[model samples]
Target: MAKYLPPLFTRLYLSLLTAIFASILLTFYLSEQFLQRSDVVDFYEDSLQVFIDVSSYLQRNGQTAEQLFKDDTVLDPEFEILWQKNWDANADCEHCKFLSVIANTAIYQLSDEQLLAVYPLQQSEEVILISDKPANSSIFSGDRRQQNSSLITLFRNDPSEFIPYLLLLIVIISLGTTLYFSVRRLQKQINQLVKVNQEFGRGELSARAQKNYTEPVNELAQSFNRMADAITETVSENQIFAQAVPHEMRTPLSRIQLATGLLRQRKLKCEELVLLDNIDDYIDDIEKLTRQVLTFSKLNSISNQCDHQAKQCIKLDDFLQGRIKRLVVDNNLSINLNLQALQLECDPAYLRLIFDNLIKNALQYAATHIEVNLKVSPKNLIMLTVDDDGPGIDNLQFETIFQPFSRLDKSRNQETGGLGLGLPIAKAATRRINGHLFVSHSHLGGARFSCQLPLKVP
Candidate 1:
């Protein structure tokens, strides 16, 4: 039964209801306690007032009854008068008995029937009975010798008693009803979210989570729909990317196969040898193209799956130095390095690609020198800049230069025969590492490519 129920809404509803009921019950109990206490205090004060009025009258008549009310040490008291003065002196006195009778008489002056337990002034041990009228017509009647001397008690438990309780019940029911509707509304919203999430998981990219017309759930629904639209667009792009792969590979593979057949015959001329070199270059480009696709796919796939892991940290200076050394030694491009000691959390292979493509493109255009600079900022940003001394890009075309298959010419003429995916590939790789890449005018009189990547602190 517990497993069948969804936990979040269940827990939320239970908690809210519990709090509401608890507050209602606690308030009811506390209010009742306060009312009862206040009633008791008010009754006690009335009894004290009656005692004072009667004692003042008796004192004016030279009766010793007034001496029975004051205590030495206590600041405020209600029952001290009941045992004040000598015990034996007023035990059998007629005057003391009369005084008790008069004190009890004063109680009937109030609205409610009041009971009194009075003691004598001279002998604090004797009981006194006082009333406004004779004993047969008295509303104030109680045993004066009763052990509990707090005799004046009034109770009013009419409609007022049940009114507050009814109000409390109403409050509880209101809260429970409110919580029930709220949970139902919340469950509906969650169902929409869950349905959309399930569709997404099943690769239904166009599916959306629709929401109620009257709530913020509508905004959330819109957001989910937007995300689904983006996912659908991305899926379409990837499908196109995957479909184009075979067509893109056919040209190079056909050339390599044909060139190999010709080479095997041993009848290849000097011109044919150059064609073989061209075939090898095509093979290399194809291989690199396949690697770029795989790299891009892996980066996108794993980015959503993994958190930042320190094991992925690459020492910035060492990693860049190694790549720079390889490019210089193997490609023989005049390259200079100015790198700093910085660590970065990233896949080292992908990071290498960003630099490799940038440098490779620079070498293709550079006339004399290629410069690489790496700097670590106090704000924990790793900045890498690569520049070349060649024909700089036209100011108007800088933004369009990074688009796939975009170049000075649409056909990408023999002088610049690349597919024009290098800058875009580099940009994608930079995004994978939560980095930014851009192009600007270079100090080397050519184009400069700069990347800002987050750093890993030791």
Candidate 2:
């Protein structure tokens, strides 16, 4: 069976509230146990003495307690006093409980709310004294509880019993103990999974979740392992193919070049020379494709050693000025550059590669104008954009353009097209520094590529 797992924050918050509630109940219980009440003695307890005095008065006056009760005399207590002769019958009323005997006077608790006393007199007769409260308080005549609070005490259940509170304490303790262990166990398991995921994200392809886990968690871990396995396998195969193809093609390309050189040295017709020049062009394109394949393979492969600098902080204005000055741009195209003074944290080499690819891509596609802008966004991220004034790409092809060897313009002419590794390499560099790359329609009537990066490398 799959175990129920609550959200992490919800469980933590619920645990906190439960802890507070348990603490409050425990504090109330402990205070009630150790702290004394304000009223040490109530009126009912002082009335116990009244029972003894009434008993004594009956014995000395030579009067029966039952007779004293019939006559409204000055000896009558302000409290209710019960003087009954039918001891066996009254005992069945559930009102009598013998407490203790002092000086031949016996005390019995009556009806939970009153006290009684018995004193022996002249003829083996006994006088019973009961402290009076109200008529509603007395239920000494019924076998069952009061039905209407008066019909028979049929509704009576003592409120001072301790068992209910004891039961409640047990329930709270049991629930609290269960919740504590459950949340603790779940947190430990979640932390283990999160740790392995973090290791995998940090380029540790070997990191895998252990099988010693319960349902749902183990199931999710297995899914992640399967995905990682597929990625690792694909990357390994691509690397071998990219490296091997270039090595294999080098021999044929070198031989063809040598043959073309020897043919150029002899006298040749115009058409033959044109054919030789076409062969040279093909060789050059092949060599360029081979180098790009190897670069694409390296970029897509997962590795920790990126030759990234430990201190990633760099001045944006100086870096841009130096790299742009070195680039060989077309003379006819009008270039507009807008820059901001910013100190950014990133691997400068990776940033340089991304910037160079974007600039080259824009230069290749622009008709007459190119715009480059660098600034910081409101989210404290670095936003760098390159815009061109040429035929823009369709919005649907935005994701497709990032794939290696993808080209929108079907014409494979080298002048206007490329092997299409530039954007992919740029995207890879952006991901390495934990950044986002997106393409959209530009205000300049052509394509716009935007790179959004965090201030710090992560």
Candidate 3:
């Protein structure tokens, strides 16, 4: 389950989203604190102004403090005036304070409580002003201890109070969506690079990463493309060199064969004849090696052109009969055939190469007889099986034999004339025609080379 977790981009996006929300919450908290402090200061300043205005009105109107205090409806909506005939030096309320002798007025500011102002009037009477909404007596009644408790209650009760949280949520969603797409875009590019790497690893030398993107990934892609180009060029050069050397050596090898043939025609001693035969054998080996190298080179070169090659609809039985007839006459081996008249669309040239190598390998190794079987499978695949009566190969050597220059211990003997490339060439030719080839222990007492070619080559 853990293995199926989200990839790197998703994890990074989640981490970034977490950080964004955390920062937003911290900013909201600090802003709320600052605004609350400013509200407190503004409340006290407004309360002081109200007290001064009420005192000035009493002095100018020539109205007695008792007349102003008695008429509650005549007072301003936000201010309330209270008259105390005797000023109490010791009050139960800790917020009450005495005025100075010179000014005879003092303001008391209580933490998390309402602001209070006391003004001494003539006749030893005192006027008190409290900073709170006149409609709510709970402000100074000690029921609400917090300065903004009512506002806080209103905020909690209102449905629109989630606006800030909602806005923050919207911002987070927008950011996450944008980051998701950006990361997906990057992931797509990285996937392309990975696919190209996989193709190159699978032996498609032309595979390359795309370099048309922004920044770091693009730079890496460009570097990868450059490296692929260099490797491809080097491999092409090596293949060309390999092909050229064999072609060059073939001409000299033919000359050697011609010279040995001429010597064989002349009269020679038994020992000389034997030495000449050995020379002929060596020449034959070199010629075979040359041919195999050229065939391998051609197979490699043809891979890129397989898509462009025209395929023909050919009768499988007729083709196999002709090829088998030639093999029987050339190798003087008894070959049995069990073929169905199946029609297949493929390159005949590639089929011929594949069959020629497999049959030749069987002819060289088989003790007595070779059996060929051809049929059309239910899946519309043309299955071909070539079996021989000889010592079968080890199961471990199945894949090894399909590799270039890979020979079994027994086949390494000089007399076999096996250059260890027959199966490799056959395998390459099989792939060129979109076919599969494998070997197993045959019922005929030797190795069976089974090939399955798609009926319709594409």
| TM-scores for candidates 1 onward, in order | 0.48, 0.65, 0.62
For residue 198, what is the lDDT in candidate 1? 79
Using lDDT as the measure, the top candidate is 3
lDDT tens per residue, model 3, 204-225 = 8888887687778999999999
- Tens digits of lDDT, candidate 1, 106-175: 2212112233334343335443333222234333223322224232331233455467767878887888
Candidates' lDDT values, in order? 0.65, 0.74, 0.77
TM-score of 3: 0.62
Worst 10 residues of 3 by lDDT: 93-102
Model 2: how large is the Cα RMSD against the reference? 12.7
Where model 1 places Cα greater than 4 Å from the true spot, the runs are 1-216, 219-223, 226-230, 233-259, 266-284, 297-302, 306-311, 329-334, 409-417, 456-458
Error of 1 at 304 (Å): 3.8
Ranking by TM-score: 2, 3, 1
**lDDT (C-alpha) at residue 37 in model 2:** 24
Per-candidate clash tally = 10, 8, 0
User: Looking at candidate 2, what is the lDDT of residue 434?
Assistant: 81
Candidate 1 accuracy as TM-score: 0.48
